[model samples]
Target: MKKGVFLLCLALYAFSVTLTIFVQAAGIADEKLRLLSSFGSLISFFAVLAMLFLIFRLKDNKESKVKSCGQKQRKNPDEKNPSKEKYLEFAARNGLSRRESEIGYLVLGGLSNIQLAETLFISLATVKKHLTHIYEKTETSGRKEFAEKVKAF
Candidate 1:
């Protein structure tokens, strides 16, 4: 969409430039009319250039935001969580399956059951079932105990 708009603006600018040159070469007798026409064409040309610049800037900002968001989501599990290694070790020690360990990580990151379901793209009941299995495997009573045990590691 932005590219189309930019192209259209470019075409309009080119047309305006050609028209202005043609008008200048036509040798009109009225100086005032010629000056007014030149000024109008100049203004339209600058407007088209401004629109193109703004569109490009907007596209750049949108692309940067999308890239940053993707990077942030992918990096958060390890980079932002200081206890990731400890959690992994804890998971390994407890013989947690991959899914349970993922749930554990999100739980440690302070996600609620609903958030866990949303983040993991699972149903709420599935999240609860995973938590139950995690609790049984880790031999912890609940989230608090699990978190305490992992942190103590």
Candidate 2:
């Protein structure tokens, strides 16, 4: 809709410029020619403004869609996913330390050891150690069992 309006404005500007040129060639009075040229200039200015408005409008529309999609994807797929407080509470009940809980959260999100190490600024060995502790504290072994325990929280 905005693009259509802008294109219509551009066509109007072209028409006005053509008319002004013809009026000038026909030997109209200087005052009349000046008025006609100025009118065309005004139309051209408005056409440019309309085009700019449409560009910005389209950009904002695209930005809004991307923002909404990002927010939607950020939602957890499982309806039974615990809130932050609930997750921390469950981790505490299972005797996991704060760092272990943080690691467990990322682990449950399916991050690999190298990815977890990079994200947490820890060594790969440290990531493996944290996972071992988490498994021990949660009484669950390996990725599948660990994830099942976290989800069952």
- TM-scores for candidates 1 onward, in order: 0.48, 0.47
What's the distance in Å from true for residue 126, model 2? 0.3
User: For residues 100-124, what per-residue lDDT tens digits would candidate 1 score against the true structure?
Assistant: 9988887877677876765565889
lDDT of 2: 0.76
| Residue 97 in candidate 2, Cα distance off native in Å | 0.9
Q: What is the lDDT of candidate 1?
A: 0.76
Structural RMSD, model 2:
12.7
Error of 2 at 129 (Å): 0.5
Tens-digit lDDT track for model 2 on 33-131? Answer: 779787987887787788788889988876765444333222346534456787788899999998999887766655667667756668899989988
Which residue runs of candidate 1 sit more than 4 Å off their true CA positions? 1-82
Alpha-carbon local distance difference test for all models: 0.76, 0.76
